[model samples]
Target: MRALVLAGGAGTRLRPITSTSAKQLVPVANKPILFYGLEQIRDAGVTEVGIIVGDTAADIEAAVGDGSALGISVTYLRQEAPLGLAHAVLTAADFLGDEDFVMFLGDNLIEGGIGDLVASFERDRPAAQLLLKQVPDPERFGVAVLADDGTIERLVEKPADPPSDLALVGVYLFTSAIVDAARRISPSARGELEITDAIQQLLDDGQTVRASRVEGWWLDTGKKDELLDANRIVLGTVTQRIDGDVDQDSTVTGAVVVEAGAVVTGSVLRGPAVIGADARIVDSYVGPFTSIAEGCVVTRSEVEFSVLMQGCVLTDVPRIEASLLGREVRVSRGARRPAAHRLLLGDHSDVELAEGS
Candidate 1:
């Protein structure tokens, strides 16, 4: 089966960062989230891949190149707008042709890969196979109702009252029959072609649609919390490989990976953390679940459980935890003499300040 990876959405939920970069290109453990999906597709023996690109097409293209780096040949398919999932499928119809394909959301992360899922599809294929996971907030996802025979009966896109806890995972396997279903379906109230509606059309056409529960973690890194959580989970699997310079005064512990050219002096790096290439950490504590991207700097500061993009500078910043910072940001301790609140905040932003500061 061919692979159709949709990387063409406006990630408005991850603003400031998404304002400058593509969400799929965001690094989880120093590797782009899109690369993870591509690696898994390669492992599944899919050689021909089509990537759907939107406004961030240039960034995605630059990062992924010709897909030779991922052991697959890629064809860039442009989407005029961020319509919807089924819309993306329609856009890729020419590339998909008559072959069965796997539709992977570029920003989704599924732990342990989809090797077995592809194997199952190759053995006994269905008209459409959806990956399902039990989520607490099914109302926020595409809800699926299953028949007694473990087949999909109905699907709803973000219903106010969900029928079941089973939510559709971002990865879907579909046959060429889905192309007809997508074409037959109408756009939902959201003004976009809903994949759930397309799948329901398959059911209406007397086609067999199946659901398979995900055995491992599945993450849709749409917002800040989800992004950081995915980062933490991915970092847990990273093996220790220190290719950088760490002074004798520095203490690097646990599963930390310091990439080449990175320097750590008089710093304490905790486990499951990575200091990217050319990054510098001096007299700082780089705690767990944190990724300091390439060329970032941290001096006399402490950070934990955060993802710092490339070229960020943190000097005497005291302590920052559970945060996501964009590239080229500089956070420094303000002058004590000023004793004023100088702020430029975004919409719905929350800030806390010490008394008398």
Candidate 2:
């Protein structure tokens, strides 16, 4: 089966960062999230891939080129507008002609990979198979109701009251039957063709719909908090290694990965962290669950659980935590000044000034 990765969203939730970079390109453990999805697709034994791109098409193209580097041939499909998931599938119809394909949301992170799911689908040849996970907030996701035979009976997109806690995961396996379903779907009240509506049409028409409950971690990195959480989750699985220059004065604890060209001097870095290529850390404490991207600098500053993108500078800053800083940002010491609140007294009321001043 071929893989169709949806890379067209505007990522409004991750503003400022998404204003410049695509959400799928955001790095976790120094690797772009999109790359992770592509890697997963490659691992699933899919060699032909089609990436759906929108306004950020150029950037996505520059990053993922021919996909040959990852052992997959890629075709870039452009979407004119940010319509909906079903719209994306509709646009990719020509690329997916007559072949079953796996659809992956570019920003979603699935821990183990979808090799098993693809294998099962290949064996059974179901019309559509959805990955499901039990989430506490099913109202925020596409909810699915299953039949007694363990098949999907119905599905709804972000219902006010969910019928089940089984939320749809971002990975979906579909045959060419979905193309017809996509065409038959109408825009919902929200004025977009919802994918849940398309899937439900298939279920109502007596097409086979299957569900696979995922056992591994799945994260939708839509907002700042979820982005940081994805970073933490990925870093936790990293095994500590130093393939670059680490000075004698530097100490790295568990699960740290120092890429080539990165240098650390007189710094203590806790584990489950990554230092990207050409990054420099000196006289600082790099804490856990943090990813310092390529060409960044950390000097005499303490940072923990943060994602510092390329070319960031932090000097003489006491502490930084839980932040996703964009590229070329500088956080350093400000001009020295005396500490006090100064207020002007109007005529009759006189205020005593500090003794030193």
Candidate 1 residue pairs in backbone clash = none
**Alpha-carbon lDDT of model 2:** 0.91
Report RMSD for candidate 2. 6.8
Q: What is the C-alpha lDDT of each candidate?
A: 0.92, 0.91
lDDT for 286 (candidate 2): 96
RMSD of each: 1.5, 6.8
Off by over 4 Å in 1: 344-357
Root mean square deviation (Cα) for candidate 1:
1.5
How many clashes does the backbone of model 1 have? Answer: 0
lDDT of 1 at 137: 96
Q: Residue 298: error of model 1 in Å?
A: 0.3
Q: Which residue pairs does candidate 2 place in steric collision?
A: none
lDDT by residue for model 2 (75-98), tens:
999988888889999999999999
- The candidate 2 region of ten consecutive residues with least summed lDDT is 345-354
Residue-wise C-alpha lDDT for candidate 1, range 1-357, written one tens digit per residue: 899999998888888678878989888888888999999999989989999999999999999899997899999999989888999999999999999999999999997888889898878889999999999999999989999999999999999999999999999999999998999988899999999999999999999898999989999999889999999999999888899999999998899999999999999999899999999999999999999999999999999999999999999888888888888888888787755656665544445565564
The alpha-carbon lDDT assigned to residue 249 of candidate 2 equals 91
